[model samples]
Target: MTEEQLQALLHEMTTAEKVGQLTQFAGAFYSEQEDSTPVTGRIEFPVEEDMIKESGSVLGVAGAMKLMGIQREHLKKSRLGIPLLFMADVINGFETIFPIPLGLGATWDPALIEELQTISAKEAASAGLHISFAPMADLVRDPRWGRVMESTGEDPLLNSLFAAATVRGLQGKDSLIANDRVGACVKHFAAYGLAEGGRDYNTVDLSERELRDKHLPAYKAALEAGVKLVMTAFNTVDSIPATANSTLLRDLLRGELQFDGVVISDFGAVQELIPHGVAENEAEAAKKALEAGVDIDMMSLSYAHSLASLIDEHMIDSTFIDEAVLRVLQLKNELGLFEDPYRGVSLEKEQTVVGHPSHLALAQTVAEKSMVLLKNENVLPLDKQTSVALIGPYADNQDLLGEWSIFGKTDQTTTLRQAVQKQYTHAIYAKGSQLYERDEELLKEAIAAMEQTDCLLLALGEGKDRSGEGRSRSSITLAPCQIELARLAKETGKPVIVALFNARPLDLTELEPYADAILECWHPGSEGAKAVVAILSGKVNPSGKLTMSFPRATGQIPVYYNAYQTGRPLPPGSNERFFSRYIDIPNEPLYPFGFGLSYTSFGYSNRSLSSAKWDGSGILTVSVDITNIGEVKGDEIVQLYIQDVVGEVVRPVKELKSFQKVSLSPGETKTVTFEISHDMLQYYHSDLTFASDPGQFRVYVNGSSVCEEENTLTFSLVKS
Candidate 1:
């Protein structure tokens, strides 16, 4: 349908019909299934059959046949015959589940993440999904927030790269409705990652400068990549609920950012305004959200129950309703729903495409790339013929897909024991301990298995329900029983290889000393066990790095490498007692961002700069030579960081500007160059303007954030 056709349909819609277009609900509302997974809220709202038929979109309802049936029923009753948009939280993979987004971030290869998203798009589209609420562009600094698993990382530059890559992969290059593609919705618009106390849906208080500098870049990056939708955060910004905050949705998002696409409320966030004390009732909530530029109310009765009444009472303008409905109709037209509501979704396609062998192979590849080698100590790449004791609750369990893998089938998950057994003849398994429970008999059995085996492979961490939305943890350390299980395995005088199956970064300080090697296998999806085994068997080298910092203690909850310089800095070599220093633990994290190890070592050498000074619009080239110093072929991620010695505002200690993932064989050396334009030096100044000032800068090229043996060069930015 053309613009004129969409506008005509909008013009003919009644206030009720228009309100319906701006409303979204779960499949239960349409009498689809009683056991239908509630996408947002837990309560069962009394949804009329007519409302379901006239509704603009449905959430969490996938499957070619089911979606076709819903479209068939919805189109028959829709007065304007606008087809319902099918959306779901396809955060990582669809059927052939990939690693969680955090693990994808750890891969540090945007191309790999893009391919994962492309596979996700194809699988999701075949299942009849039109939109994926994915690539959760929230920059998470606090690992206590359960949803950190969904974020790329705490760095704006890194998150932005991944965001744009995801948009391109999900929606394709030209059209959003192209072959095996679906619309990408970058989520939690503002600073949802900065929830107070690291709690989900908590208050967020950020200054405008901090908001723009830290949290807003990823969303803007997604928009610039042509993402079709934006979802509002669940938290309040500046004491105003995000769902109804015009300052966020209107002045900042639609105004400053120029995001012309639809703005959606995150999972009942619209009606949450009432509980947030910003709205007196549902009517007031509906009015504020619609007026504030929220184009859709997802999984809430606020719009359906009170939007029309607000317009009738002159509390909200009818034009607001018209504008929101027009965007919905426009999306429908863009999806080609007006012509073919099925959108090529079929049972045959679902059968052939959902879990295709190629997709499974890609999932395994991504899973392999995402496993971070935190510690090796010359005990990794366990021999395939070695007798191994795989002891853990996850040893034989199939719950490898982390939280938000709604479409994944657990029966398809290959457990660690199964993968090990398939590869070796002398692999024994036992349940060492539960995720949060301790059983003496289980520990005894595990100990016996360890004694009988050459080595112990212990898997431990939070369960599926512990590290997603609404699963924030006060303490992020391993459970006491799991730690005890690790201790018991170590007591057996066997080389212990601890493979973690967690979501967020765990406090591994307690368990680190007990392990000969540690692998941060962050819930590596359906083919997760296979990937872990391949890496352990030396078939795949560990190349993944940490995107988010792993704090040494929970006291250092918001630790990251790119922290701002303090006015009262700690004495460099004195270890002064009066400076800004933690009394117990050091200020630095246990593992810094971009920190990962491999079986093979890479050495950086010959750092050089094109010039000492660069004009405002000039480009400077920074080059470094990386040599594969170890005796194996491997991948190395070369990172470039810059520090503004003096700025209008306090700058980070060092900001990640550019990075390149290079692979080389033993004794191979390659020169990698990063072209640094003036734009790379720009920052949100004290006056809130984004530009670079005339100042000295220090550039460093290294393998990780804590670059002890870093190569540095000094340069300057000058006004032309």
Candidate 2:
């Protein structure tokens, strides 16, 4: 924009007017689902969408603006005459929800992830939303942490790439364009996953190295992708709340990285700092925040109330206020709002265009691609004549779309029972439990259903409400009643298939042993029912792998595959004293990362690598032959992982370098190959420099992260 226009905007703002831009309010309007998913909380709100525009030349407002019509009328009343940007928690979908992120991560495909977010953005942008809080980049280790379902997984490198992909999907080339896309916000700026005791909104005490190497890669990747905005975490990093940490705000984010976008706080995060004891009062919280470079406050009155006095006292510089307001205005300018504030406003096309069938198709493709077959014993892909019994709270559930599916229509999506009834001639269903049920009647019903059918499909797991933000579990086990029903089903002598509708992994020791097949369906959105049907009818082959590790028990709370080995290593085949291995149970998780099963089997040749080559100019080709040993056709994700033979410091035993998802006809042999460049082999070392060292390398081509067969390569990194 012309400096003249910017100066004109700043010139009209009184200290009070400018302070108004700094504080954001949650409009009283809210939305809630009726006939809610059992475990999903009863939090509801009215759709007051207009409160946003009514407040200002915007300062900005979270969704449910108090009055749709009035908000527009009054927003023009502001001194600066700018429109408010409507913000909301567009976690998975706005209207056409997709599967939860963890489930998407299980697919381990960035291209598909980018595609789904593209669909999500289209639906959300059409609904008058200007910005969406999405693509959560937390590196989760504990399944007990309910929000684990929201992040990708525990690997920094993989999650980093996904984070960037999500940003690109939502923001398109220019979200701030005329009806093109909505702005994307990469969230919880710091390490929110390290919350104390794996609880949400808890304190985080972490070393700088750990912070940079592990929790910060995703955010850096998002920044590099040109994300228009950033959000602060709710917890403290070291001793300072992330919302008010100047080092994170000014020194690192702005000074070092040169991120020119506005910094938005997490929901009510600015005020939350007061209760965190970092700030004395709301007024002080505002002082610390504006000083720390937080440009916008979400759902908090702190900035709205105290910024004027801070500015008058010279405690907060006018230049800082100018910088903050300019960032918001620059976005408005980028969005061409200066040209026309009504760019995205429309009601005539809303009815027919928003949740149409094309949108449903996109959701279905994502759901189909995201479903991971965790365990298969040939109980899946049943013939049309098989008399199957579908049982579980989720079997008949109208809410199969999954977590973070905020605006989805339950009736529109297909249910497991409905999908099954359409296929089998004599399919029966039983609730078994209330999802958290331990009642005897439910168990009796489940057993009865199992007795009537030749096979059983139990859909018992966490409900949609049990695994999002502010939702953590003390026990990562199957709900009590489901276990009893599962135990009983084991004795029925029928082939049992467990369809898990949970966001995170469960302690399947009691459940897995009793099941012949298991499908981890993490809340497939709108086409969720259709995706389940595809898997059941063998229309779409399930090839998704686990991005997160499934622990054998809660005792392995922070379980993950790529974790650092304990100083005293546990011998896999031998027992040694004082090692990290548990006495009663093995330290290994129930399933390793990149772990999945297919209807057909695959074979991997022992890995082979070429001799050493130069770092900057060399290309490493690692190939594998995957044969479909089963009669049916299928797809396989051949994984290639590399280990640094030696490094300046200890490193993960192996890191996933490249993978290919190949579809093969029955008995069709295909060669899958990946090229490893210097960038793929580099790691951040003691000096914070990333490089591929001059040393030998070991490569493994296997089905997943845990490779039973492998080979080696010798490569050197000469100066480029």
TM-score of each: 0.98, 0.93
- Tens digit per residue, CA lDDT, model 1, 48-92: 776776788988878888888888887777776778898999988
The per-residue C-alpha lDDT of model 2 at residue 659 equals: 78
In model 2, how large is the Cα lDDT of residue 622?
70
> Each prediction's Cα lDDT score?
0.88, 0.76
**Model 2 agreement with the true structure over 1-720: per-residue lDDT tens digits:** 575887787787777666666655543322132122222222232213433332333222222223244346545565566766666667777677788888788777888888777877766666666677877888888888888888888888778888998988888865454464677888888888888787888888887767887888898998888788898888888789999999998998998878999898876778777788888987888888888989997666677667777888877778988889888878767766666565555665455557777877888887787888888877778888898888888888877766666667777777888888997788998888887857678777877888888988888778877878778888888877788777788888888888888888777887888888888888877778778878877877788888888888888878777666457878667676688888877888898888988888887653455546565575877777788888788888888777776677777777877778888887888877778888877777878777667766777777788866324444565655
- lDDT of model number 1: 0.88
Best by TM-score: 1
Q: Where is the poorest 10-residue window by lDDT in model 1?
A: 32-41
